[model samples]
Target chain A: GAGVSQSPRYKVAKRGQDVALRCDPISGHVSLFWYQQALGQGPEFLTYFQNEAQLDKSGLPSDRFFAERPEGSVSTLKIQRTQQEDSAVYLCASRSGAGTDTQYFGPGTRLTVL
Target chain B: TQLLEQSPQFLSIQEGENLTVYCNSSSVFSSLQWYRQEPGEGPVLLVTVVTGGEVKKLKRLTFQFGDARKDSSLHITAAQPGDTGLYLCAGHNAGNNRKLIWGLGTSLAVNP
Candidate 1:
């Protein structure tokens, strides 16, 4: 069985640049989530999707943060005009069902906004 | 607002010692989960507690959900060096089951 995976394990972007982090969830998983983890901090929720529909984006810190899961499979978290404050590890997770289902996480993409 | 707070941001102990990590919240939660993460890796789920005052054990690790579902605790006994990592607690509110409120995490270093 394959676990969740993310591409571009490490990304270095200059301030004002745009970066897109990608995540591939387990096959047939119905739910996906994105979280951001700053230095010495726990992961904070960013957004959530159930299939192709984005259910929650309340956790997104600002308008610059955007995410989408098109066709109900892979997902992308895009940060526009990256700032130094955007430096963090972006984690993606997937679950087979709703509610309290255990989430399987990807290795995560470490983004460094310099 | 729902928030989770974890105490003792860091812990260092020798092998075979016992330690406990706490997670507290002011709001009730429908479910609380514990996760362990190592460097350069994502968190891996350890356990999920849904029932109030419920207790579950895995190996020498024990997990407990508070009687009011507003807190949780994780205890590890006979710790090993391999247990060194960050422990995080996340709670899904009783009202909104999808969103999870996360704790800052407790970094534990178990020396051999």
Candidate 2:
């Protein structure tokens, strides 16, 4: 793909429902990141992956948040028992290698828990 | 924890006016990057400053990294409506880790 792509641009889920958001990073990119951005706030790091190896999950808010990059090219962020507070835009970004490489971001999935 | 704080959470100015947004941190960084985001879209990288005391210019926009590598600023000269967006600053710690700490971001609105 020309750029990072996310699925379900907009989603509305009832409280307690589980939802999954997907991201397709740029071809052959080695680094992948997931972030959550609340209304009127900047994106907060959620997790990071280095070639299918989940190196960093320190930013995941709680047990309900889980992310995986099985093949290192596409990733999924799953939220279990979603709450009203879970409503936010989920963003995915990718970088080529490591140090100082620029990160390209996806359009993001806007999740609305009603 | 290393944190980046951005000033003027929101700014509205007339076209042709000049403005500057700042990002500050207490910890030093190896590199800092500036990004601009529009509504319904993800942020796009605008510039990256690696060396302390470095200054980079992108047409009407100018970016500077602090001498101590703990702060940075973005200045726009003769702003235009096209420049209206959310500006964010992110920095990588010097520990060789790839994690980036992001600022709160400055939302700028340039009205024509």
Candidate 3:
């Protein structure tokens, strides 16, 4: 598909378990973003990557949350020692450039912590 | 910190009904966008209003950006069952180049 795609569309993890979610953005897209959305809530920005450089991660909830976009294309978000509060849908989006506001989104990964 | 507040958190109406959802913020924005998300899927961009007081329409949906760039609204006319989804509003932080502040979405359910 030409649009962004996320892997492991659903994940179930136990407390303290670590999990990694993957995102494949549209080819040639330069900006990538990760967001966490709780049930009934809008997506909250977690981090942003401009090519291979992770430009902003201030929105990450904790140190346990980490993301990488090596090769400047596919990205991954890893959360260590997961907590129940971490249960939410993780969404990935990519924009054509840093100057544009339109973002193409992936299907999102729903993480359920128990 | 920038924040967007949406009103009428949840709305349920029969097909062909009309409704409006609002997103308000105290901080100004460079641009505002509206998205629609279905269950288990990410949001799809519906419209982006760049100029204040700009109005855009797509089929039965009409979007308006406040003149102050601090608020926006979405109005649907003769809504259809296919319109059932979560409607979200996001704004480009005027202070940040790429950061977007999002508002709690309005859950819309159109009964047929």
Candidate 4:
């Protein structure tokens, strides 16, 4: 599809198990964003990447959460030693450019930790 | 820290009913955007209000941006069953060129 796409529509991991979510953005998109959405809450910013550079990751909940957009296209969000609180939908979005660009979002990966 | 709060966290109404959802924040934003998300799918952009006191309409949905740029609202006229979904409001943080602060969405269920 022309819109952003994320892998593993649903994932269930045991506590302490690691999981990696993938996102494929629209072709030629310059900005990519990762968000965590807890049930009954909004999607909170986790990290942002402008091309291959990760400009902001201050929103990541913990050091175990890591993301990267290598080669400036597809991106990956890796969570180490997952916890029950990590259960949430992970959403990926991409924008065309810097300012005022409309964000196109993916179907999102729902991670369930047990 | 910037935070957006949405009212009526959950709403249930019959088709053809009218409803309004509100989003408020103390922080000023350069732009405010509305999105609709279905279960298991990501949000789709509905509208973006940049100018203060600006009002934009999309079909039965009308969006308004507050004069202070710290709040916005979405009003639906004669809502339909198809309109059942989570409505989200997001405001752009000028400090972060590409980041948007999101409000906890209002989940609306329209029964036919």
Backbone clashes counted, model 2: 0
User: iRMS value of model 3?
Assistant: 0.9
Q: What is the DockQ of candidate 2?
A: 0.75
**Between 2 and 4, whose TM-score is larger?**
2
**Per-residue lDDT of candidate 4, residues A73-102 (tens digit):** 999999999999999999999999967779
lDDT of 2 at A60: 95
Local accuracy of candidate 2 as per-residue lDDT tens digits, B13-93: 999999999999999999999999999999899999999999999999999999999999999999999999999999999
Chain A TM-scores, candidates in order = 0.97, 0.97, 0.98, 0.98
- Residue B75 local lDDT, model 4: 99
> How many Å off is the CA of B26 in candidate 4?
1.6
- After superposing candidate 3 on the true structure, give the runs of residues whose Cα lies further than 4 Å from its correct spot: none
How does chain B score by TM in each prediction? 0.97, 0.97, 0.97, 0.97
Residue B71 Cα positional deviation in candidate 3, in Å, after optimal superposition = 0.8
For each candidate in turn, the interface RMSD (Å) is 0.9, 1.1, 0.9, 1.0
TM-score computed on alpha carbons, candidate 2: 0.98
Give candidate 4 misplaced runs (Cα > 4 Å): none
Residue pairs with colliding backbones in model 2 are none
* DockQ by candidate, in order: 0.85, 0.75, 0.85, 0.85
lDDT of 3: 0.95
Q: Which candidate is the best by DockQ?
A: 3
